[model samples]
Target: MTAPAAHAAPRIPAPPSAPADALVRLHLSESPYGPSPHALAAAHRAVDDTGTYPDPARTAPAQAVAELLGVRPDQVAVANGSDELVLLTALCLGDRQRPGVTTADTFPGYRICLENVGRGCREVPVDGIDALADAFDDAGVAYVCHPHNPTGGVLDRAAFDLLVERAAATGTPLVVDEAYLDFAPPGTPQVPDYLGTGAPVLGLRTFSKAHGLAGLRVGYAVGRADLVGRLRAVQGSMPFSVNRAAQAAAVAALADRGHLERVRRGNADARERFRADLAARGRRALPSVTNFLAVPVPDAARAERLLERDHGILVRDAGRFGLHGHLRVSVGKAADLARLLDALDIVAPVTGPGPGPALPTAATAQERP
Candidate 1:
């Protein structure tokens, strides 16, 4: 018999290219400053150890994060990113027979994760905490993306306290995603304080934002030791989920408080300036405590495309997150914001009828004392 015909190797498509130098990346909420010098040095050093397997326990990063948050290493579970932690939470805690509860307008990843695992998700309005409580009563998991994604609204301490109490009373798992909490003012309530309340709460954080390490993809979840243990068990299966370079960088980034503070201050200034510029141009920007501002536009999709194609500036169309006719623009460096503002001035004049009733502002919820 003739030799079998040579098999053709499947062609793998090339991954998408990174943003070009001229492309203003206000879409992803990435830090404009990039990683700290210490983190960069640590990452470079880690590159020399590429031949060895990374620590599966993620011990160094875990201990660093635990110390920073006043939690024990056993209460910390590191992952490839907080997104992975979110997925792990769903896989480990969600039940097909029950549902996951969350705000209708959220980061979208949580709903996607829950639904991907064959569980239903119930979404209530962001301000509908009572409805959320009722939904959580019957849910296998509850998620609240504090400093909520597109709108950037944060739930007050009282609201979070109530949620924690409900979680305790109902014996449900609560996931508080603080992906942008580092940008909020100091003294903002965080997840570590609730750990001793006998409630199953998982506080998810990422090094991507204030630490300027989005490219590294490192994050962690901290909570009760038993609950964290469960997450760690799931994380164990994905050995080296967080590579050595990322873990080292995250640890170094945590120690660089000056860098983080600079990011917070710079972002706060840029956010306020951007919002004010928009207001001066007869547009409304939803008050934000996070690094991005959500501004209502005539058409989100059209505005996003116009900015990219015409101005070489990229922005997220909040319609993807159920906030129609709004654009989520990241706070960039002063020069970058100047470029964006100029581009906005050019694009804003031509945009047609604006968005409907303004979404609720975070002013009521996130007002700094």
Candidate 2:
């Protein structure tokens, strides 16, 4: 029998890995707070029912969301998360090769999703909607994440109305990602409130942020009945038959108006204080109505790294959004804010101790101590 030849030297290519020990994360925009106590209790209650498949239609939670927003249950379509609802909605209505789907440079994922579906996206500044009317096709769609990420600014109601009117005029569908709307200033428009205007708008909300249920992954869309049905068909049997527990918690959280108000008030106070602190320290902050503040510094990446490595406190740097001079910090409650502020003070470099011990003008350089 012939013997096998000697094997050649083996080759092992190193796998590409993310940088080691590089901030396990405050980069992801998740709530540092845990879910509500009531939501936890509901999850426990649902554990016994794990033996069975959840209802494909998810009627109960849909009803809960409907009641919360004053819309018919049929008008709502629940999903695994706001992302799911967004992708499904795009699948149902957005045509990447066509003029329908559009988003600003704010979030890349939305644009990526649209591109995946063969739809095109256009980037626009987060100003009045009037500036964006030219981008909508006669029969297309538009998507905007209000209180936009990486730049937290709310387009005024007048601008929202302009968007609705433009969409109505062009027979274009508008998908408004109000995922952070609950954290918006009070009296922000509700799902039904926008729907009542007779414009083709779909409102997306999530339990992930304000309800502190990001891990549970429950969110929904409020839209015209026909539109909701289309998304349902495109989404198939998802809406996770398992999301009931999270829904129950969301309902309870909504009912606890006092708790929600407290959370908002805390965020408001934190945002103002943080901005003021930044100003006192000679930094700029973008105006915002959401639970986060975007601060503009000279070198945001450097600042972010310095804080994480030196102080173990992290905030999101806007390098991904092309705003390399800014960072986004989520507004937390009192203690969290205090911790962040302390970290900021520790990490931010003091520029030359300002004028070096009271320089005496032209005579100062010669007489400096």
Candidate 3:
């Protein structure tokens, strides 16, 4: 018999390609207009001095952040990004025996850090503030993603007060991730107000969101001097993580208040318009106070794939944060939002009546940070 005919290997289909210029990245919540001109100039200038190592003490950036926040330099702990600060908080406060406490649908970085250190999270429902209070034992750290992640629902003032009071009573370390706080209304209460309350509170702020410096990877934590000192101790052994150029950019970014305001106003307008467009198409979006919104869809994962492959529009599937049937769309420029709306019109056509009022219900809740 002739040698067995050579078997043909099955071929896998290649994914559909999107046009290079048509790609609209609305997934990471980056600033559509990019960094301030002053920040860009400062970063470019600092590039000339890269031959030398950055200040191991991170003095200039720390002082800049402190000045902006009306706190002492000693109270600030600068890091690679807010994500690193989250990990540092977990490393300092998490206990392998006791699970960390956080909202079930909040940012996943804190929980991931805890798990990496042999700890787990005890997640409470987004609306279950009372349950969260009960879970606040002194054995582990508690993370509060203010204005919450995927869903963008902030704890009311009363709920926040309760959380702080309970944490203070239990002597639990509270890590408040305020990465998206800059997008909230002006004069909103920030973490610095609770500094001297005798509770170990670490308030995290980042240059990524409103500051438009995500690529620079700069963020800081503010707290009581003692708490900040603990984080410094943990970060001491590492080489200068925040680079010199990034430090310069962050300092300059903080000084450009006008740029920040413009970004905030533009985002607010675009976010409302995006929500209205979705509503007109029979989709519902949760109320948002940040640079993103979560809209419920028939199948979130499928929707994400379809948007990218067919329309060159990128969005996040909320399933990664334990949310089902929702997509997280970051607020971009007006043109970008228009593109998203046009794409949605095709991929997600309206069928029946539009969804009810934009309130977040159990079936379609998401949080943002």
Candidate 3 per-residue lDDT, tens place, 215-312, comes to 99999999878778888998987758989889888888888888899998888888888888888777878888899998887678888999999888
Residue 153, model 2: Cα distance from true site in angstroms: 1.5
- Candidate order, TM-score descending: 1, 3, 2
TM-scores, each model vs. reference: 0.90, 0.81, 0.89
lDDT of 1 by residue, 130-191 (tens): 77877777899999888788888777787788889988888788899999999987767778
In order, how many clashes per candidate? 0, 6, 11
Report lDDT (Cα) of residue 300, candidate 3: 80
Per-residue C-alpha lDDT of model 2 across residues 172-273, encoded as one tens digit per residue: 778888887877766655446778777777888888877778877788899878778888887674535336566556555556566566666666776788
Give the 10-residue window scoring lowest on summed lDDT in candidate 3. Answer: 1-10
**Global CA lDDT computed for model 3:** 0.80
TM-score of 2: 0.81
| Model 2 alpha-carbon miss at residue 50, Å | 2.1
> Could you tell me which 10 consecutive residues in candidate 1 have the lowest summed lDDT?
1-10
Highest lDDT among the candidates is held by which one?
Answer: 1
Clashing pairs in model 1?
none
Number of the candidate with higher lDDT, 2 or 3: 3
